[model samples]
Target chain A: MRRLWIGLTYAVFALLIVVPLVKIATGSLEDGVSGLLDALLRPEALHALMMTGIIVVFVTLINTVFGVMLAIYLVRAAWLHPRIKGLLNSIVDLPYAVSPVIGGLMIVLLVGPDTALGALLEGAGIKIVYALPGMVIATLFVTFPLMVREVMPVLQEIGSQQEEAATMLGAYSWYTFWKVTWPSIRWGVIYGVVLTVARTLGEFGAVLVVSGNIMNLTQTATTLVYQDVENFNVVAANGVALVLAAFSVGLLLLMEWAKKRKEVH
Target chain B: MHIEVKGLSKSFGDFKAVQDVSFGIKKGHLIGLLGPSGGGKTSILRMLAGLEAPTAGDILFHGKRVNDLPPQERGIGFVFQNYALFKHMTVFENVAFGLKVKKLPKDAIRERVQSLIELTGLKGFEHRYPAQLSGGQRQRVAFARALAPEPQLLLLDEPFAAIDAKIRSELRTWLKEMIERVGITSIFVTHDQDEAIEVADEIMIISKGRLEQKGTPWEIYKNPETQFVAEFIGESTTVDNVAALHGFEEAAAWTGTRGLIRPEYIEIGKPGEITLASATMRGVVRHIHFRGSEWMVELEIGDIRLITYRSLEKDVLKPGDPVDILIHRAYLFNESDSWIMENKLKVDPMPVII
Candidate 1:
């Protein structure tokens, strides 16, 4: 019975994951490599991929720095009243509660081109709703909780003991954080960064809605795939998706490595 | 340095962890903040180390107020309960951390860290991470790391609590000897009376967030001034009526109904081994159990059961046999006061001093 269940699990995994991955890989090479290359070489696909890369870099960097700070503040700030901290902590997972499309819609409703603040920013010569900034913000909103979720537990587990020990030994606060706290949570931070990057790469609904899906300006790879399928260009969609799926697989491997390293201590 | 805490108190929300605790440490004295769990010993230690801000009162180091001094400038070393050795750093790096923070000369850092590693007997394991070390080794690393910056004062919170039973006693002796050799004024918090008595030059007993008593181990043991101190310090059992016991029946020193008897205060012997004159208290052996180096004999005088220890080298006695008991002293306590009551039949009554 156990063997039967185990076999069933693998069969389900192959059908849902392995089979789709193989199909994407083969479908991208339908014209014996020209199809994948032609689709990737198109100016729109390149621009979309580049835009996605930019958003992933921006979102991951911004989220890693602020997410780690927020985690530290939530877990270690003794001055913050526990009640307020608890309220803030409970709100960290708001990104997960609302669907990404709804999150994108919220941003659009608050700061779209037609909104008063959006028009003022446009009059000031800054474009957000159909630009890189809005795209990054949308992805940031979606991936904001990943870094905090990963690092918070690590910070709480290590506690303030080593930091206090450092302080007693005459290390300053920043010095203690650098020497004591950072090293303990570095792997957690790495895990957070990878998760953020993965989510940013795959973020479609939020980025598409917030950035107005503007081709060559705001279209991300996932958004490009959606556009390709809508235009009945299935081969191009497969090519872009296979590239995205390949990066996701690499990040999955990185996550596995980080997890093993995390357990070393 | 002479450290003094004046009316130090701490409260966590509504829970008062430390309440109006005040004490002074003479130079180079090893003090132990001994208490049960949640009795505010650790809170008091943290306040002294400037790790926890006092809810009220002040801390003085060398007669200067250090209430506002951050822990980095407090010139103290602190070892946490679980050692808190930096898991990511090697033993050498852990010891060198303080020096590095101070931006010492590289040569000086190396020399100091090497000497501390050697001093902690971790000479060869300098490059090993904390995860690679045993609990005892990790504690040694924490100790070495704490001492790296050459702080004037040291603090430890349950330093031996993480180690297993066998290594704990050895670490206690090692820690005490190291503290003496370093000649640094240090305070450690622990719940184990044995550890406190073994390591601390003076033990401060804490209960209910209050400092109950403070004295040398012998002073606290022989001259417990309170009922809590009497019953909490050692292997003592409270008695309902001490007046019913032989030798103490007519002693004028006792003025209360409640009394505590320590195992060491009573001696048990076989019938033939005791003199008839000294064998005023005849007790029937109720149960006998083999204790480590002694035989734990429970005896009954009338209806009252008492516990006493007999050396293993003595003649063994079985249950229901009549035996001789000689109680040297017991702590007698009333509602307000406690004092030592001696057996009038065993020894001359001497004035008890603290």
Candidate 2:
């Protein structure tokens, strides 16, 4: 019975993942290796890939710091009123509930050029609407929950006993965190970081809507692939999509590896 | 260090965990906060360790009020019920944590940790992580870690609760002796009266967030000041009435409303086997439970049932056998006070006033 179920699952996996991946790989090589290289090395493709890299690094860094802190606050801060803590917990998960396009729209609505905050920032020489800053903020809004969600369960599982033991032994709060709390939660934080990196790298709808898909200014890799398909450049689109798929596959493997490490602990 | 807590109380919202509890610990004495589960023994320990803020109280260490001191500033050692060893760190690193926090020289830290490892009998297990150690070993690591900084007082919460039955007794004796050798004022919480009686120099009985009685285990065992203490400190069962029992006429003046008796205080034997068989009451054995080294015989005398232990040397008792029962003494208590009621035949009979 188990074997039959496993075979059926493999069949579905092939149709959904294996076949499309093979098709993308073949399609990207349609003009041969040189043609594929030429399309990928094009100035616009290079710029979009660079934009995606920058966003992934910044978003992961910001998300990891705030996310771990928020998770700790949510789980350990006894002084917080339960209702307010519950509300904040749901707010952390808001990114998962709202559509990425709507998240992008919300960010633009709140901080677009014509909005008061946006106008003030723009007057202070900060262009946010069709710029890298807006792309980062929109992506941040969409992927805000990943790290916090990963770390919260871990913090809860380990409980506050060891931390209390550390403090009772005359460890300052920071030292207790680094010595007792951090080591236990490091795997959880790493798993969250991997998830955040993957999500940031592949973010599309929000980045496209917020970045405005300007040629070289804020056009991320996914946005550029959309523009390629829109302009009847299927070969270039396939090349960019192939790269994104490969990156996603690598991230998936990294996530699995991180998960195994976490379980071992 | 001499420790004093003046009206320390703790509440979790509507639930009062520790209420208006106050006690003192003489220097270098081992104390046990003994109580039933959910009876607020651990809450008092946490407050003493500075891990929980008291709702209203003054905690003094060597005559200085430490109510505002953070746990780090309090310089106390705490062993949690679960041990709470750092899973990621080796036993050596776990013990060396507080020393490293003090930024001591590496050699000093190594020497101290090494000595503690030997002291805890975990010499070869130093490199192993907490996951690799047994429950008893993990408990030792917790003890070593807490003692690393040589804190003023050590607080342990239910120290032997996580261990299985066999090793628990062994660890209890080991912990009691280790605390004596170190001679640091220590307080441990336990629901197990045996653990407290066997381990602590002084035992404080707590119930419903209030201090019931505080004394040497012998004092609490022989002369419980409150009904709760008399009922809680041992395997005591409440006797319905003391005046109806054989040779207990003096109990009438005591108004023994809630009479409590310990199994060891009640003697059960074949009619002539009991020394004062003439003054003994008649009871039929109801059930016999094997208690490892002794037999716990349940007996029914008139309207009430009693429990008494028979040594393995005694002839086996059957369920329906009639036996002579001479209760040596029992505790009698009313709402406001309690007193010990002796068997009138064993002591000089006093004139009953009531």
Candidate 3:
């Protein structure tokens, strides 16, 4: 009886998540699977796909550079005040707690038009909100934690010994980092990049609010899928959703394969 | 190269690990930094290697101060206690690591690494990783890696500690010969007294981050300067109140303490009139231990227990036997009980020295 109850609970939870995806896949395939493929190949849908790709690429690049720096800084600069480090580390997770709508609202309130910094940026001809830059900002906010979390543990584990050994071997600090320190954490950094890419590609809530869901200009696949669902175009929504899911799953598999290769070596 | 350390000190927060340590090494001598655990021997070595900065002192290499130099620039090799081999590199790669860092020509690097590997007896295992090798073999690889750079001074921190006793002995013999052949100024730290005695040209005994004594192994063993050094260097049998005699007054005055007799100095003999004291107060023999070529006899001499070794050629003394013992040549000391000159009793000193 206990096993039955546990199985029932798991089944319900799994179905709650899986049913929507199954329905979307089946709905997209009903009018011949080729129709879903054709919809994906359409110019508008292709443009939306291109925009999402660009967002993922740009956001991942920005997050990788900053995340690696943050990890190295935290590990090497132990003399920094503990409370300050704790504050900075806790701030990395702020995006997770804040609702996507609230995050978008905060960004708008800080950088949209009313704030001094927003006005300065606007005066400099940089349109942040309701633009590609705004989309990048939202994606960066959500995916920042992924890379930092992945790389920090690896940096901590490798510790300062190898770096010190390299220094003792006559290599300059930068050379030691590149030759000795980087090799040890290369796989970890790659894993983090993969996670950041996946998160950026699928990011919906914040991007939807910040990008203004502008069709052909700022409409990402996630936002496009939302538009399709609202317009009752279930098949189109399912097609876009399936593409995002497939991309995420592929990246996850790549990360897992890299991890296994590391273990083997 | 000769190295001199003067007034070197290091502190970790409120605790001082090494304090006012000053010593020097002659060129091409294999010195052992001997001490109990936590004696700051490794700290002193690290300072000399420039891995650590002394709080207040200077290290001179060949009469030039090198306190501000980095480890690589200091041109000293260090072998960590765990052998610190790069796990990701093969033996050849590990040995070649230093050469490559120096940016030597490819052929020179190859030749130097190969020569070092051959010198360390690691010719056949060039392709293996450190994890695949045994403890002794891994240590050899570490030695080869450190020596590849042809460092001015080689520092080994407890080099043979990870190996078993039998392997440790064999490796120590091999290492001593190799270091001598190279004639590199070398310093090795160990808590094992026997290792220091066997390998070092001079042993610097440290206690509680201070230098207790520094001398040749024979000098240290036969003539320890302090109580800690006496107990640490070799096996000793300490006895209290053997009753001072008038003939030992001069020797006692020089030592400023009481007298002590080494086990080997005490001989069993027939009682004679010249005997200082009779072996009157005696207790039962407590134990007789066979120590290879000799027997160690423990006797309850009155309220005090005394230990002495008897040769195997003589009749084996067993427990419960009553034997007459004599102190043929005992060390004399003054009121403070410090070791003084030997009370020769007209015996030759050649046998004792040998």
- Which one is best on DockQ? 2
Candidate 2 per-residue C-alpha lDDT over A1-265 given as tens digits, one digit per residue, 9 for 90 to 100: 9999999999999999999889889988999998789889999999999999999988988988898899999999999999999999999988898999999999899999979999999999999889988988998898889999999999999999888877877788788888888888888999888888888888998987888899887888899989999998888988998999999899889889989999887
Q: Give lDDT tens digits, candidate 2, residues B136-155.
A: 99999999999999988888
lDDT of each: 0.88, 0.89, 0.80
TM per candidate comes to: 0.91, 0.93, 0.84
Q: Which stretches of candidate 2 lie over 4 Å from their true place?
A: A1-11, B250-256, B268-278, B288-295, B311-324, B345-354
Which of the predicted structures, 2 or 3, would earn the higher TM-score when compared with the native? 2
Ranking by DockQ: 2, 1, 3
Pairs clashing in candidate 2? none
Native contacts recovered, each model:
0.93, 0.86, 0.27
Give the clash count for model 3: 6
Shift in Å, residue A136, candidate 1: 1.6
Output the better candidate (1/2) by DockQ. Answer: 2
Give chain B TM-scores in order: 0.93, 0.92, 0.88
Backbone clashes in model 1, listed as residue pairs: none
